[model samples]
Target: MTAILTFFTTLACIVTLLPFSRHPHWAIRGMDFPRLQFAIFIAVLLIANFVFLNKQSQFTWVVISITALCLAWQLWWILPYTRLWPHEVKETKESSPDKQISIMTANVLTPNRKVDKLIQLVQIHKPDVLVTLESDQWWEDQLKVVEVDMPHSIKCPLDNLYGMHVFSRLPLSNQEIAYLVEKEVPSIHTTLTLDSGDKVRMHFMHPAPPSPTENPQSAERDAELIIVAKSVAKSNQPIIVTGDLNDVAWSATTRLFRKISGLLDPRVGRGMLNTFHADFPFLRWPLDHLFHSQHFTLNSIKRLPPIGSDHFALLTKLTLSPTVGADQTGLESNTSDHNWAKEITENQSISVNDVPQVDNSK
Candidate 1:
């Protein structure tokens, strides 16, 4: 019995560590499963160790050593949060016509029937822009009535679960659906013209989750995000990317996305706003995120109530600022400011050649 327990425990631990190791396809699907597996293994090991110690087992030393090693590894996973989070330098260029923009990102969980709850939340908050992920034809139909109030919208209703819909009080320019990872999965990308006539590019995405039923790997998802990050970095306009990323805030991939895109997360100094697993809050982690370029300042950020979905909605308010001089330009903006804007010159040319082409065929 002890041999069987030890073997399974060791196997779980090894699998847990495999994602962190340099694997050919590390970021394809959901990483939470491996993380949960590791947690379960540790819990089981702890219980076994306690039982063995109480009985004064002969192999207590071996058990203790293994437990200690696992604990150390767990600690390693937590150390990154303690380090200084990256911040963008403030820009001097003042916004032409400063305006406050409120955005809400929600994953409505396709099968969920709480349409009224979602509607109530939307009416209460009255955000300038609202993005919903995992939306389908049914979800879209339910939300159609609200479009009258929003005036402008981009709807891509699909049964594939990757369908997304965006509603905004502001005007949308150059709006298009982009297929970054898979053909069936599409991300909404557009420039939102605020009341002040200032334009900011907004990219809303919800990639396929990594799991056995899905792509079973996370490499493609990670690569897709990297492509988006690179595009955001090259943009001369202020950029806001928000969605249920299907990844944790503190994960290695999220950090890399921030660095490569030169965008700032508002949650730094603030607590982890876990938005997933709304039914069981304790098991949740922050999956929905709002990342903005250095040219915008955070006015406010908060997690909204459960709207009969597996995930909570994230609401954020921001202001826009222009870049200073050429020398001061490109310096990252602070994560805390209410009005932030990065300067992206219209003349700057970026070839789409570097981005990975999605294979529409499975």
Candidate 2:
């Protein structure tokens, strides 16, 4: 019993401390996720060590103290997502329908041939804009059922699982497909003309995540996000960027992205809204995300039901407000942030064509 508890205690301490370093490998950055799980495990270990281990030994006290401290550290990053912290984005008070925009972003797991559940959510939510990732030609064809309502569309269907398709009810223009980091991986950029005659620029991105099968390092993902952040920071009007960031909200990369982009996360003060690994509650995390400029206020944001994909649908309704920006101040970037962004850009760790292609079939 002592051996088991000691092994887990050492593991938890190492995992908790790994994310503090600047390493951008998947193995290190991946530790940024599951702070909640770490907290839970640490809490369990703290209790188990007390009950099962000898109290006379100095090792028991040392383990308990370190485990307790780790629990507090994990909570420090997680409490903001809960109800404890004040909302970074203000909830909409103005009841202006014309000035509102509702969007739904979903990852249609390539091999998951279930469209009915997703289609049903579309009907129920009736989002003005729908973005689908990991969608192939077949998934594109299946999604056309809603095209009659969402007339403006951009499609880039690929078997590589990085494919993305965007359909919007509002008029769209200035469309451009940019391969920011990886040549094969593409990001969709366009301007949506809303009913209020307001032009909002939208950048939809789904950079390949760092994993055993995907890109092994976080350099490509960081570079792509940093590029988009610089672009978003320059915009005077409202900008909406959404997709699977493949990184946790609290990660160093994501925090840097927010600082450079000057975008507000609706989930910051609301909830984590875990959307990935829909089948496994224990493994679920917030892989899918939406970030927007200060001019927008959250009208509604919720996690829709699982739609035959590994990710649950993310629906967000936001209103264009002039006064809300004062309440929800955009995260400002410091000199350190600018230097970090420049470093990621200059590294050029991953070539444009460095990523090898993968099979589409599951």
Candidate 3:
């Protein structure tokens, strides 16, 4: 029994350390998804070692130390996302409708046909912007009920399961569909004009995940995000990028994206708000994300109830305050982060389609 426990403890330590390497293999990158679970398992092993192990031999001490170290390593990455740490995005004391915008991002599982539940949530919240990922032709048709109120929209309904559509009540200018890394995957890039006449650039993406059945590496997904992060870095406009990123919030790649783009995650110091694996409470991570520039102060952020999809929708209300960026912490990037960003972007072999032309004449 002691040998088996020691073996599993060693395995947990190995899995925890694998994500530190720069390798893109699914097995290595996949370790970034379950830090919380790993921490819990490590804790259990530590307790079992103390209670079940009668002989405190050298091997027992080694295993216990490894379990403790692994737990600390996992907590180092996850602690910031919990209330115990400071929030990366500051919370606003109050907000006016004219200066605030609510965004709802839902990755409606392509095969799940319960579109009415999503529509009902839309009607209830009436967000300024609604971004649906994995939304093919069927979803586009089902979501038509919003056209009566949300006049400005962009639709790219593909059968490849990467289809994305954005519906907004606010005016959207320079609306274009971009194939950032993969031609089959479509992302929405546009400037949303708030009621205050300020323009905020919005980028919605659903990059393919690293899985056995899908892309076996994380390079493409990482590169697509790096491309967006670099593109937004050139502009001073307030930016909001949201979607099912297919990566967890605590991953090194996601952190690099946030640092390079200077976007703040409301999840920091709030909660995990895990959205994926809606059917399995025990196996879930925060795959759906809403990241924005520091100019926005979070009003409210929460995971909406399940809508018959594998991912739970995320709703975020942010108040746009031009001076708020100066007050926020941890949004700045260092020279090393920028250098790594360049390396990651240049190393990607994926080809992106030419930027789609946007007509603002409407």
Candidate 4:
């Protein structure tokens, strides 16, 4: 029994460590196979330790230690989702009134027929901006009523699941549909002019998922994310990037993006607002995120009611401000730049002019 326990414990350690390495090869086809394999191995070991092994035995200490290590590793990945990290709200000196910008981002599952539920959610929130992923021509038409209220909008309707649509009460500047990965898979990039005349760049992405039926590899997705991150890092305007990233908040790629972009996640130190698998909340991870530059302060963050989609909508309100200086207090450190962004940017053929501009008002 001790031998059996030791073997399983060793296997669990191997499974957990396989996904820790920062290699894109491990992130294939909309599935982090290594992470999944590790999770399963850990579960098996945990069950064996509790159910099969004697608690008072010396072997049990070995099992507990192994289990604790695995749990610690898992917790490390989940740190960003907890939003516990202290964040600095740069002092404005004059007590500037909060400039709230409410946004609602939803991956309205393309095949989902519950349009009413989505519409209802929007009406209730009355968000300043609405971003929908997996939206096609039909979904666009269903949301037409909102246009009268929103006035400014960007629509990229495609039969492919990559279709994305953005509607905003704020004026749009340099709005374009960018093909970041495959030619057909597009992401929306635009500058939002707020009521205060402040401009903030927003990137709404729904890249091709890494799945057997989809891209079958995560290279394109990872590359696209890295490209956007690098671009935002160099931008002077506040950046608000949102979408169904198809990667978890705790994943290696996601952390790398945050570091490269110099963006702040609202979930850090706060609970993980797992948006996917709405039907099975416990099994879900945060795939939908609202990441912004340090120039903005989070007003609120929430998970909206499900609208017959695999993902639950994420709503976030941010108040924008200018960065005081590099020595600004309250800014959390310890973020690591893995040099992934520089490598991907070197090979990307991204030209802001190459993106297509569409006037949905027409």
lDDT scores for all predictions?
A: 0.69, 0.86, 0.87, 0.73
Cα TM-score of candidate 3: 0.95
**lDDT of candidate 2 over 164-243, digit per residue (tens):** 99999999887877788988888898888879988888989999898878888998889888888876776677888999
Residue-by-residue lDDT tens digits, candidate 3, 89-128: 8888767779999999999989999998999999999999
Q: All candidates: CA RMSD in angstroms?
A: 8.4, 5.5, 2.5, 4.7
Error of 4 at 21 (Å): 3.3
Residue pairs with backbone overlap in model 3:
none
Q: Where's the lowest-lDDT run of ten residues in candidate 3?
A: 352-361
Ranking by TM-score: 3, 2, 4, 1
Cα-based lDDT at residue 239, candidate 1 = 78
lDDT per residue (tens digit) for residues 228-316 in model 4: 77667666667788998887776767777877778877777667777988887556777898888777766678899889999999998
Superposed model 1: Cα runs more than 4 Å off: 1-16, 24-98, 321-362
Off by more than 4 A, model 2 = 349-362
Best by TM-score: 3
